[model samples]
Target: MNNRLKSVISAAAIAVGLCFAPVQAADLPHVVILATGGTIAGTGATSTTTVGYTAAKLGVDKMIESVPELQKVAEVRGEQVAQIASESMTNEVWLKLAKRINQLLAQKDVDGIVVTHGTDTIEETAYFLDLVVKSKKPVVVVGSMRPSTAISADGPINLYNAVILAGSKEAVGKGVLVALNDQINAAREVTKSNTSTADTFRTPELGFLGYMQDNKAHFYRMSTRKNTADTEFDVSKLSSLPRVDIVYGYANMDRVAMDADIGAGAQGIVQAGVGDGSVAAQMMPAFRDARQKGVIVVRSSRVGNGIVARNGEANDDKEDFVVSDTLNAQKARILLMLALTKTHDTQAIQRMFYTY
Candidate 1:
């Protein structure tokens, strides 16, 4: 055949291939459901048995099967990442989930990913994944207040909302989010506020980032900073991290707790300080001494809301501590622990606090 004739045949073949390739659904977006056992997968005898239930009873497939409405929003696929309560989740589980999210995001057919997690440590996992997974696609973490067997179970609806949020164009590149009780929250700011309430999870200071309504997700605000997907830190490069301790500050507090953590070989310490992030005077010398010995000290207030002030504290400033800006103490501890994996520089740590 002539060169021109050959080119015409090749173009025709390419056109045919393009036409036959799989297409995303207009009614349903392609979604990957990564199920790590939580309340959503738990089973109980009675409605009030929220805490005393047997967890991990329902696997990802069973959970999806129970909530068939998820099919209306996305083409869903399930992977059982772990079958344990959220309390049992560890750094290993976080690494495993991050790796899987990375793998799924690489696929052309996948539009988003949903993680079903236990409420106890859902925020920690969400925050961990938020800092690690590098994907522009929506990654949503969701859980339930009631078990599947309960009369007023909230899992099915929460799962459906998560699917809607995951598939929506608005959710892409907003970092990892937690969709619960019809509210959309950034993973970095969301926390489980109540043990048994349907409206348990919330982002206290910033409020809900968005919400799912009318089978669609509507965004009221946009996350301004770069997160897991856009940062220089590589998720796959991390292994096990050093031990970190969170010490709560209170009135007339003794320095024994701080010294205990230091003596226990804690590589990092998070002080859940009193109001406005102030530590008791007695604990100041111990904190300063810990910093002198090369331990990382981060200051976060025990109060549920507001930023920790960096100025006007003699011992706090002397320790070269990084202040938690509007993040609750527990969440701040998670961020500091993860940040320590990369660097110990106080400036870099403070920059991370501001950005994320």
Candidate 2:
């Protein structure tokens, strides 16, 4: 029991204990972040200037490094899908992202996915994945209203919460989720409501599925919408989605917009109409004519909430037009575009609005 023997025994014991200790980071779920540029990746002249900023200026590597807390929750990896404002996000990009997600999820190493998208169209992208992604693994879409350089920027924390949700067992089979502003919104239920605030996204009709507290996902409810593996639509084989446009209906709005969309080769048009999804007096003729010419017309409310009843004042039944249940115009447009990829039947399309 000399000093040298005592030191050797202590070193051996310490090495044995180290071998038994669990490596927390290595044991966590693996999440892949697909970064599509938005305010989250934006850069401004300074922290005080928020009105006009250059978005998608940062790449995936820089963004992943910004939130160090992400390492504690999951084994995160970053992939740059595109670096463009959400408004510039196109259908071609959607197909590419969806296909890539499917490919990644097929790997044994991937447990979930987190998509960093521009807030402008995050809902559309999330819902599209809900319909087409045929997996039970969690897919959380996240975005921020303020640029990364803004004062009190919400990007870092939002991205952190998104990673938390993607790693959570509670998020599986729950459709494509939208994680932002401490709220967990189902893709089918959430919409962006404000142009400049952290709390821009809201679920007006159905409300959020849950909220994040203490850096974890707290599930309160779940959506019954047909999404993820339950959805009938598939974008895997689709090379491109048909051209669908939105036509806003107002007090004196004319058929000019609808006519123009038809001229632009719109295969489907989402009419953001008045109360109860009613088509304006002057626009009904154009809608009917478009329906005759193989253009699918979907009546959705601009009022933000409530269902657009089938066969209601919009004359959806007689006009052979479809109705969007509670989908806002943007979401309605996404669904219509995906639905057209499957079938052209009016009843089938109507069923899509009701079920999805």
lDDT by residue (tens digit), candidate 1, 303-331: 78877777644444556878887777777
Task: Supply candidate 1's per-residue lDDT for 14.
Answer: 97
Q: How many backbone clashes does candidate 1 have?
A: 1
**In angstroms, how far off is 79's CA in candidate 1?**
0.7
How many collisions per candidate? 1, 0
Off by over 4 Å in 1: 1-27, 314-316
Worst 10 residues of 1 by lDDT: 310-319
lDDT of each: 0.84, 0.90
Clashes of 2: 0
Model 1 per-residue lDDT at 337: 77
Q: Which pairs of residues have clashing backbones in candidate 1?
A: 134-229
Candidate 1 residue 177 C-alpha distance from true site, Å: 0.9
Alpha-carbon shift of residue 344 in model 2 (angstroms): 0.9
